[model samples]
Target: MDDDEVILSTPEEISAMAEAVKENLLPTKSRRLYEKSYEKFMSWRSEYKTTSFSENVLLAYFNSLIGTLKPSSMWVEYSKLKSMLNIHHRTDISQYAKLIAFLKRKSEGYKAKKAHTFSPDDLQKFIDNAPDYTYLLSKVAVILGIMGACRRQELHMLKIDHILDADNTLVVNIMNTKNRIDRTFTITGKYYKLVKKYMNLRPNTCTSQNFFVRYISGKCVAQNIGINAFGQMGKTMAAYLNLPNPELYTGHCFRRTSATLLVDAGGNIMDLKRHGGWKSTAVAEGYVDNSIQNKKKVSNLLMNSIEKTQPHNATTTYIPETELVPVIPAPESHQKNITPTLLPSETEPTQTPLLSQIQQDSDIPINTAASRNGNITPTPLPSDTETAQTPSLSQIIQQNSDIRINTAASRNGQTITISHNTIHNLHLHFHK
Candidate 1:
């Protein structure tokens, strides 16, 4: 239907509709909510006051909302609009329920888009190529996000005094956070130079303790710049870098990036949750989800563990001069025997799977009966078995348990004290 075809019912159609709704019995909050909703409704569909805004209109508006904001924001806005119809316009209870149901469906669709923040490398690129003079602010925002793992609003609320260096370590105290909870994050040595640089370059040196201040009038400092300022800065930097969507790199991107970087740097989800000030691990999980670097590291570690756990005679492709193997092939006989078991694997398990290998050489144990103790003792050298002067179990054990060492001179021109510690060190070296 053409928007022009809709007839205006009154001179002030929107206000008339709101006033009519106000006449109905409702609470102050309900009346206020009605007024706000009616105003917003009129802003979108001016004819909604006179003509019935059909379901098509609702769907159209919801569709238009796609990509305009986050799913959660869209849902909140939609809920507000729907609620206004019920509370202010006195929409029938049945119709109100139906409208909310429809909006819930729309919200799910919005959520299906899968919100994502910028990656570390991309964020770095944006910072590196960002406009001159803006580099300090752009990177500092990201650093604060990482160090404090705080949301944009909390970081924006930070004051100059937020950084306390009593113990020679810098820290950022996050106030006015999402959950209304306060927390502090330690600024470690890795970010020492960056924090110092930001402190030196930070604008608006105020007598008050606001960490982030802006310059407004002459030489005066403005207290607590808005979170939108950081977002604007991100957008401007994105534009200067010729990014696809400049608005996507808002201050929250820094927070998400911080969590992601920590995950890459061997930090755990619990640590991320604490640092990011998240009520639950869900948000932190999103920040680090599907991380290719971390996944590859985990895959490599699992593969290494599989190799370490394999039978010693497993025809392993070991690194030269070490017992560790890059790749190991199971014995042909074992593979043949296991064919039946492998045949049933039409569906692979979604979780991590263990790798199995069979011994291919005679130097290792195969049967469980022969695999006694955690220790594997190398047999006396046969003519065929080329043996290097390997360390002994006691020496290896001593080295693992104690620092005490006793050297024994070799009588056969090459005698060496092979301790348990030497073996442990060798194992650690090979694992690395």
Candidate 2:
């Protein structure tokens, strides 16, 4: 009813409103991060009086950050800002190839530092040495985190109702995973009993529905475990086991530890992917590549193969007995026994005819696989032409090449040979 208020009912206005909503296109969890990233760029742009964005601006911005931040952080900020800029300003910077190359050039020799993982022996020490009354919560968290390959958020979001007890095992369901893929894992043996003990200790008057609860002194408390507390379970176990660099053991150490242990136990990359709920083969193979047991196994296998090596057998081919009837050698100019049934070679003219271009002669009998099963019905040379001049052995094969020219005496041992460049239609049936 108020005429002063603007009405946005036109198609163009509606489209503008649609584009305006894209400012929140980033993931719900990372919107705050995107905002912070975008704010940094906006502040820089304001200081330099750069009103518009371009590949040049992004390149300069990253170049300025080169000395101030770690190479990895520069990339992180680039990605966050790229996504935010696309959504808020409708600028697509992903097609900036040169800018990407510059980032890659700057990132040379920059290796990411991985989180430290404790071994099964270390975990065993924690289980046996740490008192159950004081570290029951830590025990349960560590076991579930490592066994299930759980992220910190997954553990934090786990509710009491998600756990199912079926006879001897306790089945735990993971619903809110990073990939949105649901996973179910079960605890058995002592792990199952340990989880059951913790479940019994959970306060009946607890207000939270989360499976993990805060424990003080010797008893469980009413408060639920925070994400940071879930993450600290790694440090707690590491410190208890007297492992070095306890501070480097973070929430992801459990996931990495699970993959490494499985690979050490003879599991393949596929097994790592399936057990850890990883979708990328590269991510799964990284664990295998870093495993010491796998490396030792591969080295031993290579050395064993070398030690067991034997001399290779001479190469031979199965020549149809009917074809290439062993040409017996004579003390004369050529072999006395001439197998006219064999395809005769033409006279050595001034030019060597390209054998590849030569078509099958009607006079030549089919001396291939088809002839092998039956008798060879060789056609005689044209009556007008005298006995065709036989091509020398060197002409048929290369100089110094291995040649086992079998004669009537060696017919039992078939030999195969070929010429260089092209073998023509001489599809000689060969076998070892």
Candidate 3:
């Protein structure tokens, strides 16, 4: 087969060579599963008495499973079938655009079940209450899983020798990982004590090199814990802590819990991504979005914005539930026969009605604060001025349109004083 030396002897091609090619194409771990998926397709062909294998045949086969399987499950089935057929049937299901669209359309509105992430308080409860001797292995695994944010496979492949003792602290090195990248973390303080105690208790008779061991009763019995056992660590801890639906806490819970707690504590998402070895920013920030503290922080921010009162100055005041003011200046003196022309514009409006004007248009005498060419100004009250106990008419004017107010009475009187207190943007004048 090497060097292409010759195409001699009629160039023989073996029928059984297809099986060898299929085996080589499949992943070693999932080889059995790949074979099973292909065998299922073969069985269906036999049952239907249709030996033909084409896009149409696959379409019909998949259509038969539409109502029977969830879209997500069908996707898994598609992956397995695609892998096997790519080698044997020479069909690249990935190139089937129509089939991809069909599955995508079918998956619309499908809300996937999310794994539960436990709170740090619940984790603390388990750590404090769970007996160390009875759960020595689990105790170490759960803490390491969360603190280091280790995946289940990473935990499974962890070796006893991989944990190095450095200046009274234990440094855990994950030699084997799902991403094939090495990650190291330190276990110090009380956490170091737990690991140290477990290490001291390891049976010398064990041959396996894995760090976590199979424990029965209160002691470690073997080395190299199974992957499934590593995965069940979350579920086991959840059940022991009396959490509802312990099964919902999958193996990824420790990883999620680690990211969530870090996010809730105001840790940077980029740092969390590096901490958990997540390459995707969306994945890292999703933990932040789900954090109870993060959501609470957003809620408070929105509320404070809506409920905001006034400015930063000491004199600034807020509107009450009912309209009110802190102070209202009292009128200086009461007067009569004084048609107060609100503004100093020499001539009053003939169309608008004053007290005298309403009855009949008459020449009304006004005050002498300002001449026809000058500006009008009202005196502002001091801080000691008494405030209104209830809402003032100024509030009604504030809510309603600005209107000119005029009054006249037929009697000898004094100058009528206008108070600028409690009223915003209001000025009135009198002519003598």
Candidate 4:
């Protein structure tokens, strides 16, 4: 080959290039989905027998499917068609802005219903009632599904060689999962014993290497179980148990129930992600949220306390029932001879006997004046005594405004004075 001349590729080189391109193609399962979607679309629009795909035709087809299919299902079909077109014609229908916008707007506010989960009790009941060999298989399946948190596909792919016994625990090797990543889990407790027993009873005549096999007509059949078979098993068990809404339970229920149970048992999100083989935290979080005890756990954390303390006592003391009853009326005869005392008029400044300075100084009796209507008034102080000029009531109040008094009145431009003895009494009364 000359430097200036371009060399033509050899047949081997072209073949190698073709092989490399083929290596980039979708997996077998994914290709099947694209093929199924394309065939369905073509069949629906058979009248338009064009060899090529058109954006208008796809839009019209998807629009017609709006009411017939759920948003999620319709979106799946759209995705498959998009992938098919891209692979074959090197055209991406999803690149059309209008189609993308339309699908996005339509899918908004759409939620898919989650599969129902079976309680541990219901699963145990199904296991107990399962007939003989079937019981062995069913018990193992339930154990693997619940304890290993295996998906139906993962469970189907399990082989007898994948399970290993290590002292007290059984290890399961999972392969070809939804995320195409392989993982292993160690299971222990009662589930480990059940798996061991199942292994012991597993038929020797079984031809298939798959751990879970069918027992029909009293014979162990070696057949690779499909995903649907797992779902059917769930339905069968539910029906046998006479459970309500048996249709709600499916193979996926095992995975969901396991995740929920782990979350309820206080398994952390990161640990749950690893146990469930989830590729994203969002998926793990969703399982945690769906747990029946999710909100209950939150409430317990927020409201419950472990420590106990004394309860608060009421501010008021409890009164006895007898104290609540009224006292008997005093005899009417005793009230007839009682004499009424006469209170002095406001104009009378009557002088009362004042004891000697020593006696008066020792104990000053502050006499409160009673009105003609029997209302008590401020005590009138003896007109400024020689030994001690009594402090005016106003001055006393100003000096100790913190003390509470009923009432005080002024008359004839004279302010009543309360003696020191009165002040001391007032202090004691307020304190009491």
* lDDT of each candidate versus the true structure: 0.54, 0.68, 0.66, 0.63
Q: Residues 1-432, candidate 2, lDDT per residue (tens digit)? A: 112123634466666676567754778887788889899899999999998789999888888997898888888888898888776676788888988999889899988777787677888888778999889888888888888888889989999889999998999999978888788899999989988999998888997889888887778989877799877888888888778889889888887887788888877777778887889998677654365676888999999998567443424333344443222123222234423233333332111222211111111111233223224332222223223245433223222232222233212222222233223222231111
Please report the TM-score between candidate 1 and the true structure. Answer: 0.50
lDDT of 1 by residue, 176-251 (tens): 6667678887776645565566566555435656666653322234455677887666566556667687666666
Worst 10 residues of 4 by lDDT: 355-364
Model 4 local distance difference test score: 0.63
Pairs that collide in candidate 3 are 327-387, 337-409, 366-431, 366-432, 367-430, 367-431, 367-432
Ranking by lDDT: 2, 3, 4, 1
TM-scores, one per candidate: 0.50, 0.67, 0.64, 0.61
Stronger candidate by lDDT (1 vs 4): 4
* RMSD to native, candidate 2: 14.6
Alpha-carbon shift of residue 310 in model 4 (angstroms): 17
Best by TM-score: 2
Instruction: Give the best candidate by lDDT.
Output: 2
Candidate 4 residue pairs in clash (backbone atoms < 3 Å): none
| CA displacement after TM-score superposition, residue 188 of candidate 1 (Å) | 3.3
Clash tally, candidates in order: 11, 0, 7, 0
Tens digits of per-residue lDDT for model 3, 81-173: 987787765678888777888889989999877668878788888877899867778888888988898888888878878989998898888
Runs off by more than 4 Å, candidate 3: 1-22, 49-54, 281-289, 304-315, 318-432
**Candidate 2, clashing residue pairs?**
none
TM-score of 4: 0.61
